[model samples]
Target chain A: MKVRQVSIFLENRSGRLAGVLSEVAKAGVNIRALSLADTSDFGILRLIVDNVDAGVKALKDSGHTVSLTEVLAVEISDRPGGLAETLEALSAADLNVEYMYAFVCRVTEKAVVVFRFEDVDAALAALKAADISVLPANTVYAI
Target chain B: MFNPQAEAMPREELRKLQGERLRSLVARAYERVAFYRAKMDAQGVRPEDIRGIEDIVKLPFTEKSEFRDQYPFGMFAVPMSEIVRIHASSGTTGKPTVVGYTRADIDNWAECAARSLGCGGATAEDTVQVAYGYGLFTGGLGMHYGAEKLGAAALPMSAGNTEKQVMLMKDFGVTVLCCTPSYALQIAEVAEQMGEDVRSFPLKAGFFGAEPWTQGMREHIEERLPLKALDIYGLSEVAGPGVANECLEQDGLHVFEDHFYPEIIDPETGASLPDGEKGELVFTCLTKEGVPLIRYRTRDITLLMNSGPCACGRTSRKMARLMGRTDDMLIIRGINVFPSQVENVLVRIEGVHPQYLIIVDRKGNLDTIEIQVEVTEDLFSDEVKKLEALRDKIHYQIKAMLNVSAKITLVEPKTIERGLGKAKRVLDRRQRI
Candidate 1:
């Protein structure tokens, strides 16, 4: 299943994060699990949100770039072997993950996972073959 | 805000301040540097007659040839042991012109560079990435010391290796960049190609110098980088990159009057022009201990402005935008060309960029000129007729303005390439060294 994610481009400065947070709050978007990527010139704020559309709109309205993508959000166990098993399955299927992140899966005691792979079909097939369930598109997007 | 005290100082006070420093430096020059003393003796310059800065016009002008004649360490005013750092400019016609700095000279250099950066809106809070090729050229180290003096975190990210430069820019978060205007444009192009927005850079501004750039080029850089593009005016001979700098207001570059005294004079007659007159730019290093020059003729074409006071509040004298050169014109064909003229035309040609190559070739003693212009998507995708028409328009404009008729060839966009250090726009393939 695909999870739509939002990435906001920001200059590295004090109070920038505050502006992003303010916009998100005003749009009523819940940032489920977030990650910050940076370079010398700018910072990229990547988030898996409860409402991707609202989050994207909020960032775009604030003059920040919003990139939306269909990504795989697999449900992994909290145990040590969980992540290793998923990674091994993808490797066995000759698939690679371009980027990935972890999120809190409320319905399961296990960890909810979010990932972006260049080849989504191959990755999904590998997960299915390993008998690991990838969450449905709706459930993952509303995370 | 601009400080009005110095610019508003009584003309008599400014004269007196310069006179005192001139007397000391001249006396020191006459005593230490044999070349300087001999040059003065040849011109019959007497110590008591050295009255003031006005008398500086009466003194001999130190040409680059004099430095070449003396070669290595002939221009230094202090002992060799006291010199802390050395820098040299490559010889265009002869031996390399070398400049040295005593410990005190280095300190003054740092202060001048710091002041220039401050004028260009760099603050202690900014992380400065200095990318002016560091080595003997002096541009890189010059900015590095100045950024350090300003108490800013300086990234000594020297020239070339564009990929690494871009990577660092994204990783380290540099806010203020010091480089040539041409290189800044090149970086902006690279960033755009990487699917990154040039405006997304943490950079608030840049101090661009090294080679002559036109106002049109400045506006282009501002449009692409969307930041203040301030001109950094200096030469390796005169303390490098800190002799003057344009503030964010972009009115005129404020010369550091207290340290270096400036004058504009006719290149042919050696007659000094009044304020607001166009002439060759000359400088006298009042506080420079290593190589103190008296009326060092810079050969650059510019104007001087005493125009009331600047918005930045600096009390120093202001210099008008540099147009070109009194000497060393960028000659293409039999007609002489100035880089600024090419820049003026290039900016108006729409799709053509300041990134261009001028090739001057010789065939059986006859000179042939050709311009290699980059073709951006805006120009390349146009019908062949449109592209050819655009090229003809540029050719006609350059010929009309500079009186030089040359062949113009269109290369793929970003293909002529972008340079992030000193922009090498001319290649005289006719002459092989």
Candidate 2:
């Protein structure tokens, strides 16, 4: 299952991240999981929000370059080696994870991780074959 | 000391020679080039009226734009069969400003270049390593032919490959280096990095030009490399690198007045400024046969000093070091880069705003240009690969167009500071003369 992630381009300057977060908050969107990739010149802000379309619109209207990306959400047991175990399957399946971030679910003792893979379909197939609990867009958004 | 008779000619005799040359040049240009004919006709002036150097004011001023207006071969006074070589420099637009030379013209250029090199202490026994980029740019071939003309062995080491440059310099016993001032320093830094004692090289002198460099840079270069750093001045439109040179006196560059006559004019009102007063520098090509120019506005700001004879025995009027350009054209790494050219590239790419900021700085003896472009919503992608691709596209296009590599930084839409009226586009931080 694929989840839509809102990613905004941020310049590596003072208060740039805060400015984007304020724009998302003003749009009345709740952030699920977020990760920031940065270089010396600029940064890429990858965000998974409860409502992707509204968050993107607010950022774009505020003159930020925003785009939508499809990432996968996987549920795992909240344990010492939960991420390690999930990663071992992807490595064996030869699926490359471009990036990943995690968030603990309040409704259960499980953790939800958002992943961007080189190939989403291949990653989804591998996760299914591994019998991992792959959550859909609605289930992740509700959490 | 090369061509001593001409280089040390008295002012009275030199003026007579320049007057005769200018008279013939106008006649040839009026009779051949239709663009020159029209401009002269529009000014209600004819060739016969320009009988002497004093009558130069009667000729129409040829602007740089006229060169672009008369594209490929429109400005050449001679037929295509007579042209032996063609050189082009970057223009304000996509097309370059083209210049052509006949056999005699090439010979004259070689002689001028040789004289320039000789002024900087080059002799027939010296081996010159021409490090300026060859091709459409005139710096490399210009110096190469000059070294050959001077009877010195010419090493056509066209720019880059720093390791090879140093290796060849040591192994071949290069006595003279010819390139932009910044690049000469770059070579010295590279040599030091390679564990070579930079000052131990046999390089005696260097002719640095094609870009504006300060006296401080010259001193710095001399300190790093054991050589007499001399400033050579020229433009492709004005017959390339041998129009003027500093004759070891380091006072001012002596304009080869017998060939290319110099004048200082008010940049705003077009009135001639007196000697020693700073204004826009203009030149009238007195001996050019292919594309003879009459009072071509050079856009270079400098003054002519006619005070007595120089200690080096050259009697030609000397021009002070170039102050700056009257236009927004930035000379990065000896390449002419117009802001509008960058703007043209930006506008052509979809979703890129025409507004851009060009930041030019000197990074470790080399010029660095950084272009800050605002990223539009239509151009951005969530994936880092796609965003990087967009940045690479801009970088590649700019490099292709300007012939100079630029660091492109894509910023948030409103992050770039907008000016009140005309948004300032260029921020030059380089220490230039």
Query: How well does each candidate superpose onto the true structure, as a TM-score?
Result: 0.58, 0.91
- Candidate 2 local lDDT, A8-64, one digit each (tens): 889998999999999999999999888998877788999888988889889888888
Tens digit per residue, CA lDDT, model 2, B214-290: 98998899999999999999989888899999988899999988989999999998998889999999998889998
Candidate 1 has a TM-score of 0.58
Residue B319 displacement (Å), model 1? 1.0
TM-score of A-chain in each prediction? Answer: 0.89, 0.94
- The candidate that achieves the highest TM-score relative to the unseen native structure: 2
lDDT value, residue B35 of candidate 2: 94
Model 1's CAPRI class?
incorrect
Model 1 misplaced regions, further than 4 Å: A1-143, B1-12, B329-433
lDDT of candidate 2 vs native?
A: 0.89
DockQ of each: 0.01, 0.63
Best-performing candidate as measured by lDDT: 2
The lDDT per prediction is 0.76, 0.89
